[model samples]
Structure formats: C-alpha cells, structure tokens
Target: MDNYLTKTSETERPEFKIPDFIENMGPEQIHERMMASLPEDIDKMPGGFPFDYTMPTAAIASELVHYHLVRGLMAAFPEYAWGDWLDLHAKQAHLSRKPANKAAGSLTFIGKPGTVIPKGSMFCTAATAAGSSIDFLTDEEVVIEEEGRATAAITAFEAGKKGNVSQGTIVLAVRPISGLTSVTNLEAVTGGAEEETDDALYRRIQMEHSMQSFSYIGNDNDYIRWAKEVPGVGDCIVMPAWNGPGTVKLVLVDQNGEPANEKIIQDVYSHIVSEEDRSKRLLPTACSQLTVTAAAGLSISYICTGLIYDKDTTTLEQAAAEFERAVQQVYSEARESGTLIYNKVRSLITDLPGIVDFETFLINGEEKNIVLSKEEYPVTETVSFR
Candidate 1:
C-alpha cells in the first residue's frame, strides 16, 4: 500500500478566512447585536440563561448558516454551480485554520489504495464553532430575604463549547469528484401496503435502497465533473470514511459579530459511527450517513437460509473457510460492476446459532461477500440412496 500525503500551506494559499460573523465590527457593538439574537427571557429572568443555551456567538451562528448554506448550495445550484463555489472557495478560504502569523488555512491528506491525490485541490470542513460565551443571568442569594429582597443578579453566562461535530469535509484531490456522493439523498423507503407479503416487501425495500445509493454516487460523479471546470479548483479526492472526502478542518476564526471572538467548532466525527461498520454480514448495521435507511444498498449482505447444510457433514470451520473464499471472489466481481456499493468494514459476529448454516448473500452483484459453515463432515459408509 504505497501512499503519499499532501498539505496546503497558508503562506502559499490566498485569503481563505471565514469572514467574521460580521465583517469589520468592534466586539462591543457586535456583542450588542448578538445579544439581540438571544431570548427575551434573559431580560426578564433575574438569572439569565446559560451561554450555550442562550446566546450563539457570531462564529457559531455563521457556522450554522455556513453548513446550511453549503447544503443549500449543493441542493439549489447545479453540481456545476456548486463546484464553482467549492473550487473558488478552496483557494480563497482556509482549508484549516490560519497558520501562525499567516492569515490562511491548510490541510493534509493521506492518499490510499488505487488513488493519488493531486495538488491545489479544495477540501473543506463545514460545521459550528465551539467555546463561545453567551451573556446569561445567574442568581446570587442575599441574606435579607424580605428586607433586602436582595437577589444579587448575575449575568447568566454560558460558555460556548464544541458539541459533537458531525460535519465532514469534502476533499477533491484524491479521486475524481464523480466518485463521491452526498449520502444525504438516500432516504429510507416506506413499507409497502399490508397485502404485500414479507418477501415481496423486503425485496422491494432492498431494491429501492440499492437504487438510491447508486443514484447518490451517480450524482456525486456529476458533481465532480462539474467542479473540475471551476477556476482555482484541482482534482477531487474521496476518502474511505465517507463524510464525503479529504482531511480538511474548518475552524471559526471568530464568531459572527462586530468584534467577533475566536472560537473553535467541536469535532463531529466522534459522534458519528463511521460507515466502516456497515460491511459485516452477520451484524446488521444501519447506514446513518446514507439518505435512505429502509433497506440495504448495493453491496449489502442479506440473510438467506439460516441453516448451514453440508451434505458431506463438513466441520463448521472447514465450511466457514470455503464459504469465505467463495464470498471474497464474489466481492471482487461486484467492485467491477460499476454500481453503488456500501459495505461495513467493522463488524463483530455476536449472535449465537440462530439458524444453522443460514448463509448471508450480497445482493445486486455488489462487491460484498459472506460465509457459513457446519461443525462436522461425515465419512462415506456406503449409505443407500433415498
């Protein structure tokens, strides 16, 4: 597995600053406007709300807007139009936070199997920034209850902290853009009418999920092709962990406000279970990243027969080995079929023997495989044919 790494330096790159929640404003004034976004109760409540719950910093607010904005961009504009933005922004914006003394951002990515990342590609992380302070009110008790009625009113201040950041970066330098699809489209399918048999409904659901997954990938490819023509953009890259691609980090230089304060966006990956677990055959995992959830996608492993029947009475270990080999061969072919494929890379066999030799199979000729086996093989004892 030969691999190379690429890093975008701030010195060489142009200004990619995430503009302050408000451009060219002093903190005092910006603070005043930010207070307006707060709930009215803070004014009424003696002890105001906490910062996290009450006031959102300019950077924090901007992040909310930026993520939705990008999503809107991806949704509203054609892939070509969206690509134009991505390409232009990658150069003009920071891939990560600005370097020391340098007012620009950069990012690094490790190229993986079958792909080589190119230079000047744009990758971006989108999400809310963390660690902002909100003007809140807190109650201070005074000894004189009635005489003083003295409740020392304190500004209920809540400090901003990063929540589980789930935003993934788009790296357009490793693989062609066509390879990456926003899984946001593969939504769950509704179950069929009551009259439909379980088999028919299950089949329909599986097929729909597969089709939607394929469609997402198809759209992503289109997105990449469109991005290629944009100025200042380079080739796109797709990563294994499917938050889209690349290793870019988006940081909030300052919260949106007149005098925006510096705050960081909490990392989102920790909260999301990576698609890596979706590949296991026995362990059923949901594809949260995929827009669709009702059924397994193209490279899914589905249950067929719950019993492992080896007429020769082969040992479970032997049967399992052979089954695994067969499945591996199938996966190789599935990868070449040019269809959307989803496989969970991380899975553990936990369930006990439910159905003997019940084997799992990959649907739609996808590049996924499974195996089953029995515990014993019988020797020929001149048995009579039935």
Candidate 2:
C-alpha cells in the first residue's frame, strides 16, 4: 500500500503562484500604465477627467485579467480545481468520488411476544449534554419471538461517521410503539464514512494514472483499484497468488483506516467478483479465484511514565486522550510500512497537547518497533500513563 500511495506530510500540492506578469496586471498597475500611455499634455492628474475615465476602465480590465487567470489555473492543474472542475478530472479518469454511506446494523428490540416492529420505525442514540441524537430507521419489519426479543435491520437516517455509535448508546425510539418496550444495539455500529475528501480523491486520481498500464491484466494494482471502487473502502492490500496460481486476496480497511467490517468486505467482493455472475466482474476470468477479507486489527497498547502536562489547560485524562489520538493517527499513516517505529510513536506522544515531556515510554512493554504481517493493521488499544 505504501508503495502505491505514499503518505506525505501534506496531502495537496502547493498553492500555485501567480506569475510576475500577471501580478503586474493589478488595478493600480493598470491605471498607472494607462495614465502613462496618454499624451504628456493631457490632464491625467488625480480627480481629473482623464484620471476618472481611465480608472474605471483599468479596474474592469484588471478584474477580467484576474478572472481569466483563475480560470486558466483551474484548467491547468488539479490542485486549483474544485467541485465541478474536480469532478470533470475524475470523470476523464473513469473514476468518481465515493459518496457518504449510512451506517447499518442490527437493533435488538425487547417487547411483548408476537409484537410487530414495523419497517421505518425510528430509533436514536441517547442525546448527550450537547443535546442531539443520531437517528436510525428500521429497514424491515420483525415480530418479537416467544423470547420477547427481535432483531431488525436498521440504517442511519443521515449518512456519515456521526451515525457510527457505540454499543448500548442507542436507547431511545423516536415515537412510541405500544408493544415495543426497549431497543439497543449489541455490537458497535460500523461502516459509516464521510464522502471522500478532495485530497483523498486526488490521491486516487493520481494512482489511477500510475496504474493505467497494468489495468488490463489481473495485477495487484488492478485488484486494488477494483476493490476501492466500492464505497467505504479506504485502503487495500493485494496479495496475488496467495492461495496458489490464479488466486488473489485483498485485505481491506474502512475509510477511517480500521479493519474493514463484514459489510464492506462483502461489498468489495460483490463489486469485483459479482459472485452471482462471474462474467460481470471487472477483472478477467483468468484470475480464477479472488478473495476479499477484512484486514486483521493488531491492538497496540502504550505504557508511559513521568508524564508532564499542564493542569491549567488540560487534565491528565485529557492529555492521555490526546496521546491516544496521536498514536492512532501515526498508526494509520504508517500502517502500510509493515512496521511501527518505536521512536515515531514516542515522538507523536511527546508532542501531544498539554504534554511537556515524558521520561519513559514503552510500546507494548518493548523499546523496539512493532512489526506486522501483511494481513494486519495497527489499532489503538489502551494507554497507561503515570
């Protein structure tokens, strides 16, 4: 993955600098040039007729020049392009930005036996002190069994990561259902992702150009491209011939870079292979077998001592949370390196908000780097600070 998509400190190219010639076309410069062009005898002084007449013309000319300059930049580079312009570039590459996806999961309802939970029944997460809840609607109707429990498929009313709630957080039903007593999720809701960012889309567009030649064959790049076409897929590790000849395996992660959930895995598989009809697959039949699986998550724990923090600005607990976030970010960026450098992790932690310094830091009780297999990606687990 790192080979194909090198993670850089900056996601976008640098801002385009206007040429000196264009810079000289500003209103003031244009006005001065026009004044100079008039005859020496002409009354071109400030507030005079010639001055007032040329000022507006110069201003309009400068505005036109600025507009055309921006249009030219948009036409010349993807970095300057946005919205519709960016879409045009993607279309030319036969790619489109992945749209946001609603989180889907099963909600278990407890109620009177044989009670019907109708489709479109609404549920929501318990509101926090911030005072808002994420709503979900039932995808299908289900009746409570003799055990007084029933599970129904549900989707978030709105798309995006805000809908990915923790287990047991969804405790409220929007409207009263007489027979439905209570509802909650047994597992964490997953697979919710925001629409692909401009940076992310640009990266994919760049990758598309690099892999165009290998697209015809069932190469690793082709498999990767096909898998990423599915919404919610962030990155993929392609292992060709992992099972033997004509076999390909793709280990995937979601948009947040955590291990892909079952739903995402199945979506990628259906997109590339189309199990119902192999002929409909994007890859050729020459790739006799294909397997799509979620990347295994390797929990990363941290232990630190002699932590230094400013209590005026943040508590130890807040600093620890910041450290955890920094660790996760580093892990996500370096996951493709197949090894998490000990120093890199320690550096990020020491730079956390409210953190001044740390006397000691150990990753999983080791001073050495953590190495992972091809199928594994690092996930933040626990942080112990003293």
User: Each candidate's TM vs. the true structure?
Assistant: 0.14, 0.81
Candidate 2 regions exceeding 4 Å error are 1-10, 66-68, 276-279, 300-333, 344-368, 381-386
The best candidate by lDDT is: 2
Candidate 1 off by > 4 Å: 1-13, 18-21, 24-53, 56-60, 65-386
Q: Evaluate model 1: give its lDDT.
A: 0.27
Best-matching candidate per TM-score: 2
lDDT string, candidate 1, 1-386, tens digits: 00111112101112223336534344334445666766777662324554434334645555545554445434332221223343333333222111111011222223232222233333332332853312212233223222222212221122222211121232222324332222110111111111222222222223333444223232333222222222211122212234553222111112110011111111112212233543422111332232211111222333333444445655445444334323332332333343223343112111112214344433333335332111111111111111
CA lDDT, candidate 2, residue 383: 84
lDDT at 252, model 2: 91
Q: Would you list the clashing residue pairs of candidate 2? A: none
State in Å the error of residue 49, model 2.
2.0
